[model samples]
Target: MELTDNLKRVKKPDWLRVKLPTGKEYVKVRGIVSEHKLHTICESGNCPNMGECWGAGTATFMILGNICTRSCGFCAVATGKPKPADWDEPKRIAYSVKLMGVKHCVITSVDRDDLKDGGSIIWAETIKEIRAISPETKFECLIPDFAGKWENLQRIIDVKPDIVSHNIETVRRLTAQVRIQAKYDRSLEVLKRLDEADVKTKCGLMVGLGETEEEIYETINDLSNVKCDVLTIGQYLQPTPKHIPVAKFVHPDDFKKYREYALGKGFRFVESGPLVRSSYHAEKHIF
Candidate 1:
């Protein structure tokens, strides 16, 4: 598992390249997001599929403001003292979903450790407002671990989004290095609690961060033990030099193998590829 300095700067493969955002639909989606003053992980995380997803008229909306309290090494979201929670964000997000005509929307947020409730109140309100405004629209929430507070986690479960996702982000060995303040087992507990609540729980992992195939399988087994329903595996791309470097570029064939392995492990749905992300093709996982 030793990585040379040369591997850190290895050129990105052609399969990783993506088109720039364009098209009228993309523009319309962008306009709606801008008009509502909303944030999206697609833009904040520099997702390669933003063009494809936005052009298709679907976008993942990020609430609770752009600033994050935790500074995860793998994330591109700004980490610092976040502003006070905007109580009206729920209505605005609901309105934005209505304006975009999104049939299935994904909602995620920055880790709000500063708040006593970890912003779960706003999380519940947002889901309620969305259901009120767009009764037919399905929702998938990529929530924070709430610092393992069961009460905060219960708020989300009480609101009951269609599918609830909380990414493990990396293998167990790399969890501390990548996530800093977050604990790997706490993440599992969060998903486990979601599953226990009869919620359709999902978790995501990023490979190519110096973890071995064995470690990946162990993580998958851990998730399966908790009865996690959906899983996503994507290559880890370094957002900047300051972030953790990509130890390897997993081949597409390897991604295929991982997908099949996860399916066999009893994950109802598995999305695996170099470009796959937590919210990529998220709508299809609702079932």
Candidate 2:
């Protein structure tokens, strides 16, 4: 599957349309995010479920800043030389988590390939501070691959989030075109290593990236081989015109099939739909 395929974009179906976020809870969440100078993937990645998630009083926080180093074609997060790592981010995130009083919090970050630790130190610190402030809270870290460095990955492993997630993004054939700087097998390795260490490992898949159903099944099997416990499969909406074009708008029935297939492959939990993302209904996965 080519990245742009001559920029021939597919029409977005009605299933992809979403309402804007409103309500008191949504405003409160937004205010807290702004007050602390925090960033969220919900905003940076142009997630369709932001209104639903934030209006319900939860959000997937992005750490290590909004600026990203890797310029993945599918991502909406800005790519450039990121500002210097902020060591104090953990405290603010911890405070925010406590303020929200959420029992299950999902945390993710933009790729910080420019950093020596690839932002793993802050990842660990954020988790630690959250635990310190909100001991009862269950945590999930939707993380970068840390440039495939074992030691940096180990920092997140050491923190022992309730569930550790890294997205496979797209299948093998489309990986290079879609992910650019990411290697297909290396992502599997990251999940495998996390599962080996007894972490509840999870990964997300985006369909509609010109991948065949056979390829999707194959990717599910590969994740199963690594003993990944949770899986999410969703349609890939082109974040912007400049990003990769949507090759297809997968049907909801197909997403159901994908869920059943993943369940049969032994995933403890699966969320498959047009709107699913890595952090979609993340709290349920830990249960």
Candidate 3:
């Protein structure tokens, strides 16, 4: 299907509209973020479920600053030359998690190809800092491919997070069209490296980007071949008009089928739905 031909703003389904609640943890987490002058993709990506997630004392922290170096057509993050890595950012992030009393934390970062180590040292430090403050909290790192750099990948692996994720973003056929400056083989190689390193690897794919069901299944097979432990499949929502458009919104039932299929294919965890991101409701699933 031609995704561009289907470009239109359909109202989010009722199931997707989450209600926000007030709580001590919510207020405390908000206050901490404000005090640290931190930015979260959970807020900046305009995540529809942010209120529900945050209200439930759950959050995904975006590290390595907000400005990304690569301009992937499907992403909402701004692409530009990023500022220098903040040495204190890790400590501040840890403080925010402590204040929130989060049981599980998802740490991700923008593509900082500008950095020599692709910000992997900062990622490692962030993981260590989070662990130091919240020893009982489960940690997940949804990292970049480090532009396929091994030195950068090794740094994060040395920290030994519970899960290390690098999103494939789209089907292999649409890789070139949908992902600017990202190669399909390079992504596969990243997963392969994670598998070889024996880390609990996770990868995600976005549908509604002109990819066929066969392509999606092929992607699942590819991820399985790389021994990825977690698979998250979600419908692609165009972040803006200039970005790649969604072909169609897969139904909730369809998502369930995909989830079942992924499980049958031997994924340890499958988070499949229109609203499922890499770290959505992560705390509940990890334990």
Once superposed on the true structure, which residue ranges of model 2 sit more than 4 Å away at CA? Answer: none
Each model's lDDT comes to: 0.92, 0.92, 0.83
Clashing residue pairs in all predictions, respectively, total 0, 0, 0
lDDT of 1 by residue, 99-214 (tens): 88889999999999999999999999999999998999998999999998899999999988999999998889888878989999999999999998999999999999899999
**Cα-based TM-score, every candidate:** 0.97, 0.98, 0.93
lDDT of 3 by residue, 1-287 (tens): 53456567666666565466567766766777778888888886877677777777777889989999998888899999899999999999998888777778889999998888899888989899989989998888888889888988999878888888889989888898788799888888888888798888888888878788889889898888888888998888777888877667788998898899899999898999888887776765563
Estimate candidate 2's alpha-carbon lDDT, on a 0 to 1 scale. 0.92
Model 2 residue 41 CA deviation in Å: 0.2
Instruction: Flag regions of model 3 displaced more than 4 Å.
Output: 1-15, 18-24, 285-287
lDDT of 2 by residue, 107-170 (tens): 9999988888999999999999999989999988999899899999999888889999999999
Q: Which pairs in model 1 have colliding backbones?
A: none
Q: RMSD for all candidates, in order, please.
A: 1.6, 1.0, 2.0
After best superposition, candidate 3 residue 107: deviation in angstroms? 0.5
Residue 115, model 1, lDDT: 95
Better of 2 and 3 by TM-score: 2
| Candidate 2 least-lDDT 10 residues | 1-10
lDDT of 3: 0.83
Query: In candidate 3, how many Å is residue 13 off?
Result: 4.8
